[model samples]
Target chain A: MEKAGIPVVQITAVTPVARMVGSNRVIQGHGIVHPLGDADLPPEEEKELRRQLVQQALEALKREVKS
Target chain B: MRVVHYLNQFFGGVGGEEKAGTSLEVHSGALGPGRVLEQALGEGFQVVQTLVCGDNYAVENMDELSVRVLEMVRSAKADLFVAGPCFNAGRYGVAAGALCAAVQAELGIPAVTAMVPENPGVDLYRQELYIVDSGSNVAAMRDVVARMAHISLKLVRQEPIGRPSEEGYISRGILRDELVERTAAARMADMVLAKANEEPFESELPVTVFPPVPAPPPVRDMSRAIIAVVTDGGLVPLGNPDHIPLSAATIWGSYSVAGIDNLEGGNYEVAHRGYDTRHVLEDPNRLVPLDVLRELERAGVIGKLYEEFLSTSGLGNPLGNSRRLGREMAQKLKGVVDAVILTST
Candidate 1:
């Protein structure tokens, strides 16, 4: 989508793959299967973790990236 | 010369789409297109047998089918194996290419097949088989079969194959030492002069060049910018309503998230097969943070969240297919979304 002139932030557990595929901005994800939340944590804590990841993604969107 | 021809059920005169589940079967003498192929092979070459299988069955059970087909070809004591001029049939092309590759590798027989370059089979087996680039036109079957026969002859006689353009096969990307008239310095100088004069010149080493994509400007205002979420995590509605493939997917779907605060496990499912989906199955929110996004939307941390989320399975996805999916999603979000969060697995 970067070619379409829209900023895109990729969240992935495998950062190298994201970079290889030429993702502009990447945020380290939690794991391969569960990128946002950890199921082992209690529901409330998992929600909190998910919230933090979303917040990080929001921050990534706002940050400027090199061309 | 003895030849074994492979064909799909339709070409073998069994039936149409309804017979796509037909298992592998062998028949003596040329069947349907095999006769055309046999005639093209000339007076000496004879099509000893024709093997037919359903496109669906061949693809679904490729491993077992290829093995059994190999055994049959071995017993036939065939001098050469020729599979479809599959044209544009993806499944048939895959089956033909796969079977030919196996026959050539295992039995040490010269094998040939035909398909369009865009067929997924081309990418998988081009290097292993001399796949004739049969343009996607079934009406040109005679011409395509002729080309397949020509290549099969050269392969069987152990003749050096010509350039892809001359031989009408897809380039296998395999380089070989070729005797040229010009020395390295002379060739380099000539190429430089041609390039400097703005004349047409072909580089000896062709390189794949990708177009540069400039990064889009960052979102300036966090409080009043629209954001959308996209995922390659293969999150889909229950029962996989869209029927997207588990791998090598060619389609994407947008599911309505309106009025939905959280993704309950039972309401959604993971359609990708590359990773262990148990974690995502336990909690769909683990893949898509809809609950948190909704909370943030309510808190007014952002202006608004897109009502629908776009999803596609990325496992074994090819560049051509994935690029289209991305461009389509981008076009849909063009003026509506100020930024996007694409989660990948």
Candidate 2:
């Protein structure tokens, strides 16, 4: 859908495929499953990590894509 | 070169949907798009006859229609068969694709058609025929005709078709063996040097890329929308009951969070092998983020979350496999969720 103009933000640890596939917006995933949070962190810290990542994605959705 | 061109009733100037049920008819000389293409194919080639049929008729009676179309091609002594850059018209696209495949197989004549990438006919016949990339409709008539004619002429003259990008056609999924002068070692060294110099060098093996999908229009409003979270991190129900593969996975499983606010320990585990799963296993929310999402839901930054999250292990997958999986997942999610956040590891 990114090609057709849908606003899609890929959160990925695999940046190459994301770029190769031409995602319009990509946020580097922190870890494989730990996309937004490190499992090793405490609950409050993990929640904060998750919040920041998701907020970034929300911000990405609002950004204008020139390409 | 004698060319046989196929057209739907509308394109042959027959009529629109009212004429869609019309049977087959043969028009001598170039007609419709063929007329546009004639000048492009130039002096040596002639569109011997144009075959007009109803889009409905051709698809409904594919077997019979194929026989009839092929017979016309034989009688015309066609050296080439050209169908529509049918654009995005589904029925016409399929008919064009089907007839081209039939003519090529039966008459030993190369057939060509044009279509936008999303056309279902592309998926069905791209490997079987030469398909020029076309716009969604007749507005692209001139450009589509030009490319089709160019490719058709090369086929009639038995000239080698170069890379799809060079030929302006979709890849037939066939890798041609070219005799490059450089040894494998030499080519690798050259590529490495070019990379080190930050220069662009095309790969020896070009990846067969799929057509880009039209982006679904953005969700108009986030607060009123139901957002769904999907991951390729391989988060599955306890014990990985569906047995999704660790790599090159073709299967995807959807697990319901339902009323759950966050994934608890022992209830979920990471099945992916491409990365360390130990951290994820300790706290499944690390991947799924139901913990944070629930907070958003409570704060009303967004609407409800979909009860289920879809999982697939996408590591080591071919583009075709991944494309299919993504399309399938999107199809299922369509109309149900207002937006999607696809997290991939």
> Judged by DockQ, which candidate is best?
1
Tens-digit lDDT string for candidate 2 (B40-103): 8899788989999988888889899899988899999998899986888889999999999989
Q: Which CAPRI category fits model 2?
A: acceptable
Give per-residue CA lDDT, model 1, range A42-62, as digits (tens). 989988877888888888888
For residues A1-67, write the lDDT of model 2, one tens digit per residue.
3432335677877778777776767888886556777767777887887888887876676565565
Q: Every model's DockQ, to 2 decimals?
A: 0.54, 0.47
Of candidate 2 chain B, the 10-residue stretch with the lowest lDDT total is B210-219
Best by lDDT: 1
TM-scores for every candidate against the unseen true structure: 0.55, 0.68
TM-score of each model's chain B: 0.61, 0.63
Model 1 stretches with alpha carbons more than 4 Å out: A1-67, B183-203, B209-345
Model 1 interface Cα RMSD in Å: 1.4
Write the residue-wise lDDT of candidate 1 on B125-217 in tens digits: 887889999999989999999999999988888999998978999888778899999899999999999999999877878764344466798
Report clash pairs, candidate 2: A1-B215, A4-B214, A4-B215, A6-B215, B85-B114
